[model samples]
Target chain A: MGSVDRKDILAPQPTAVSESVSPALEIVGLSHSYGSRTALSDVSFTVSPGDFTVLLGLNGAGKSTLYALITRLYAHRSGTIRVFGAAIDRDPATALARMGIVFQQPTLDLDLSVEQNLRYHAALHGLPRAVTEARIVEELARVEMSDRRRDKTRQLSGGQRRRVEIARALMHRPRLLLLDEPTVGLDVAGRQFLLQHVRKLCRDQGLAVLWATHLIDEVGDDARVIVLHKGKILADGSVPEINAAQGTPSIRAAFDRLVQHGEPSQ
Target chain B: MTSETVEIGSVPATGPIRLTAAHYLRCLEGVVRREWLRFLSQRGRFFSALVRPLVWLGIFAAGFRFTLGVSIIPPYETYVPYEVYVVPGLAAMVQMFNAMQSALSMVWDREMGSMRVLLTSPLPRWYLLTAKLLASVVVSVLQVYAFLAIALFWDVEAPWWGYLTVLPALILAGMMLGACGLLLSSTIRQLENFAGVMNFVIFPMFFASSALYPLWRVKESNLWLWYICELNPFTHAVELIRFALYGEVSWSAALVVVGFLIVFMVLAVIGYDPARGLVARRGGSE
Candidate 1:
């Protein structure tokens, strides 16, 4: 990680032509259901550039469903998802090209070497060979995994694999990054490292981030938080705003109060 | 803010980005390359695919040669050796097996989350699926040719030019079988269910076709069984290759095989549609 200067690594590349001013991600009237069960209903939110918004929800709180809708893995007929002003339904290619994702489960080909895995992603994005090679080096160096580039993915530790995934996600220089419970099984130190790195990306690169997790401690004091329960949002605002609204001193207390009562803190 | 606006080297600050034909071609090439690399790494798979057909050609064909005589068929000018007659069938069998093997990998990919990564790409889902099918077809073609070469060494030789004619027939047959495999994969929700596919799909398709004996021979023994053999798509595929291997053409067989390929490929595309497929039913969460 120390090998590359932060400024150089964070510099924006021209991957898309965005003349319109729009939120990095905007979801409106997003609803989905499986048979008789509703997973999400009339959910709406906006993540602006440079904002690190945490989607806080426990298991089956519809966090994964929302991610699925945004990513177009499961299409929702009732809602509209826009990335950088492009509607996912009407102009999915453009919207998807401007976004990056780290799914909840590990997606690496364990039999492939680290560099081969990254190269495959680069090719999928249609990056020119010269640019792909340069970005691969730069991103690998940022994750401090340059030395492990030739090693097969199965040879690396779980923390190292996560770092490689993060590096690969940045290959296309996406303006918006969506990570679904990325730190799920990591140890304390690994989780801290990943959180710090992503936070820096939001601050330095002006990249909008939607980090979904159930853990309340991951939310910083200045970060925006959306608390989702059973298929709807209980509250949405900065940490302090949520705290004051619930008459609690911490986000954890507010979360417990809201989820237990199935409403806002009083 | 101005510092943030500094343009990186060479990349334009703003321009409308449109995906071109070259981009689609690159994606196709990448997919094919990945499949090739995986095939190279798994040496056992290559050998196992070859062994199945070779065993039939070596032992089964030899044992049947003395008992079951092959008379003059459309493609054959005179009495042909049973081993020579079964060459095309066995080669097509290699393709059928390889296509299902490719489907098995898709099931595994779905379980491991790699399928999610591929589906999330900005490219159209149909294009991605077609590229995957083509990759599997290429691998099947390679295995078919390898078996042909071994059969040649064992004196089950076709005409010198017949080998050249069989290339396109093999490709078409491979695509048809591979598309069927893709359809099965999209419907199958679990890896454990794949064994059922082998029993219900692979065995029935293979045994019901003319892979083992001539249609006329079956009609002499059982008229109902002969009609089922005549209707099997694998039967047309085998006949297409058989005629090609004899430096001739079977227009009806060619048409049926091509027709089946189109139908199976269409069904595969529909089976993988996000709204109607198993992926949609599961919501892709698990």
Candidate 2:
């Protein structure tokens, strides 16, 4: 079960010329609406391998809608979403196979054990039994959840449940991991732990991560930030770049300036 | 060595992950196993599914035995007992209720966000929906068999070979009814409105069919009602089961059941299609 290496699980190989050149994820002219309500309009961004990108938005700024489009939960009428250069709409299985997502709401079955939840996900992704078992152990261990594999998810703490969900997302060895407001409802310590863990994954495993959140504090100096406001992107760059562009000393101040200005500052 | 040993030597260097036939089979197996596990854990659901049919059989059938007159039917050479005549209908009843219950579980899954986990799978939406539909059918069929066993113990007996013949019929009927439930679940957005939906759907489907009375009996009383019974897919399903349980075959009924199954399943797949589905129209609110 432990024969497979941890780094080889989901890491995009640099040796593949085609894959190495393509961004882990790219969205162009992506727009969506529900009847008259436009959730996202002309949103575009790209995340390279090993990049920890933060999608910062206020409560109704269309972050969730964007995630929905990328995950193929809802089909977008305008624009293309590509994963590892494969267009999601044209080649969904290939695109989706390279991606993993942790939605804002908890998606685990409370009645099932942590291992059971992970096993079902592995099966859905078409992982063989040997590979699934090996990856389950490796991922649970990564989240420091090896001891609670057999326990029902309902028995775990809020933070522990979130960790298990993260572990489950990794079961398929996705090169691009998308998390939507994963820190919501967690304590400060839990939030910090989760943020640090994901950041570590980006640095250690060279995986492209898109973390969407409304909280500005989740942004770090080394992270790239995409600020979304009222169905549009207002800013996209590193924290320092955003701060310099907005003439502010910090990301919070830059965020305030961007929200007040309400214009693209890419 | 610990599980974390980063041995990059044996890992495949580069290639798109390809899915095989075995993977699709495993996915189907996983979906069925999850349903079975959930059903076993929720003992109340199993017992309640049994009780509904048992109550109709034990109390309603006994009370109506003296009042209702069953004449010589095609499956029977002579007049048959009311209990015997109603067993097929009662068995179909179990499936109808179970199908609706499974649909309600889909609604619950959507509300709770597990449906999103399922939809995000790389598999085609139709295959995933079919797997889910089949899972519900398996559970419904189990309950139907349990009900049949109890009925047999209580003297509502069929031919020995009839039991074996009825298996295919039960599966077809279960799939048709379960597909209808899937269609409802996909279209009906709010869980709060589900009870009203269930009442509007279940009672009409059960009462307007040949489940309770023969089509001729319904025609004798009301011509329009008889037309509804004849048109009802549930009626065809019930007749198919009845014929099979009598060591006979109803090709017309079988055809109707198969046709309805295909139609309902196609509509169900369309209803769950991510591009034009209710979930898409609502923009993932549920």
Candidate 3:
């Protein structure tokens, strides 16, 4: 796969079945292991552009292992990742350029201001000075953090920090945003706020988002939720569809069904 | 930016924080800057880096001067003062400290959750590690120059031309130690176990090398000890610095240090490889 075309992702009108549709993210037969312990095994999925897809898994469910492979931090022994349709393994830079990632871990410099952190990230992508400053301001505003630009990241609350991370992830205005547990430390309010903001960002920016989380509440009925367990994806489909198959109306019940049965449909 | 947000103590949440290539460089740049700030914030690491070398140079060298009367080595054209002879060793000491500091920070980073942030960046691991190594080497060079300055003040002098040669020697020595540090950081599974590994690696490497005494000096005690010195990469690092400071090239020393450097770096790269889990631990995978 190459890059997902702008027309495929953004066109207001739908085409016939014969019309080609390109996915923003495509992973097939992905697997990773440390010694004999497999972290991810033959995970396959596609995230269409403008779609908000949530990856549901418990702690140690290989969400990060999959994220690592997608980012190419560690290569999977077998499988392929295509971001915006470009092969991540063959041409990582181009593939990576089209995607934004917010690691589950806090990657910010506590001592530096929020703006400085974004500036540093910008330079890594070789962004020009004027463009970086402009994007920093824009992204900060998007996260409702425009005023916190100068404050040291260390001073920010956990929720504020995660917002900064989300903003930082979007600095390049990527087509796909890969968020690994973006709300791990937040309170109920914080989690709700972050999810709402991220959902809005996807809508406003036409970004395909792969949100990894253990909380079933984070996955909406409209979003595509892939249930991962013990390194394998147990189910893949719309949350409502999966829930219906499991005879559960709520996402929490659906998740319980999937975990109990080890498959959504069965 | 509002005045409230701009307050030094205040944590601002102005607009959003965005990530780009520039942002990544800024992250690394920020790390280097913060490290310098934190390092300088406490005068302890600085003072220790300086004081330890001076203690070795002033007290130990002085006491040993009488008992360890030195003969002419091939590198030294004429008989040199014991202090003068150990200058290269002191240089190696600086490099060693710098390398250990790099390793020490890796442990600290793991503890502080900073290393995870760096690893998870979109940037290549090699580039990130290179930035760190460069910063370590630069800081090490500064410490060495400060030590040299102190040596000059103490009237322990090398040939003027030797100062120029010290630059390359410093680079090689810094790399040798820095790479070793990288390898150790990559291999050691956790910060808690780092001290044991440090003890295993640092003391042996230091004592086995010519840093404390010349190869010939050890040869008099045991031929195997002399062979150990030859095999000790730190010895070559010391020899390289020693020869360079004295306006000569020891081809064997150069070869050993460079070879050690390449091997250390290769090992480090292998250790940090994503598939290998060298530096990738399991404690904080959320």
Q: Cα lDDT for residue A127, model 2?
A: 77
Candidate 3's TM-score: 0.85
Measured over the true interface residues after superposition, the C-alpha RMSD of each candidate is 3.0, 3.4, 8.7
User: In model 1, where do residues sit more than 4 Å from their true spots?
Assistant: A1-19, A263-266, B1-16, B284-286
| Candidate that would win on DockQ | 2
Summarize candidate 3's per-residue lDDT along B1-286 as a digit string, tens digits: 2333221111111222233455456546745655565566457788889888899899998888888877898678888778888878888888898788888788677665556555545456677776677678877888888898898855778889888988888898898889899888887766778778668887888889888777777888999988977898988888888888888988888888889888988888777777565554332353
Candidate 1 lDDT, A73-141, residue by residue in tens: 777789789887778877677777778899889999887889888888876766666777898899999
How well is each residue in B63-115 modelled by candidate 1, as lDDT tens digits?
98999989898798889899988999999999999999999999889887788
Off by over 4 Å in 2: A1-20, A263-266, B1-17
User: TM-score for all predictions?
Assistant: 0.92, 0.93, 0.85
Best by TM-score: 2
Distance (Å) between predicted and true CA of B219, model 2?
Answer: 0.4
The complex in candidate 1 yields a DockQ of: 0.39
Q: Which residue runs of candidate 3 sit more than 4 Å off their true CA positions? A: A1-21, A263-266, B1-43, B74-79, B107-124, B275-286
In every candidate, how many clashes are there?
Answer: 0, 0, 43
Whose DockQ is higher: candidate 1's or candidate 2's?
A: 2
Cα lDDT, all candidates: 0.83, 0.84, 0.75
Q: How accurate is candidate 2 locally (lDDT)?
A: 0.84
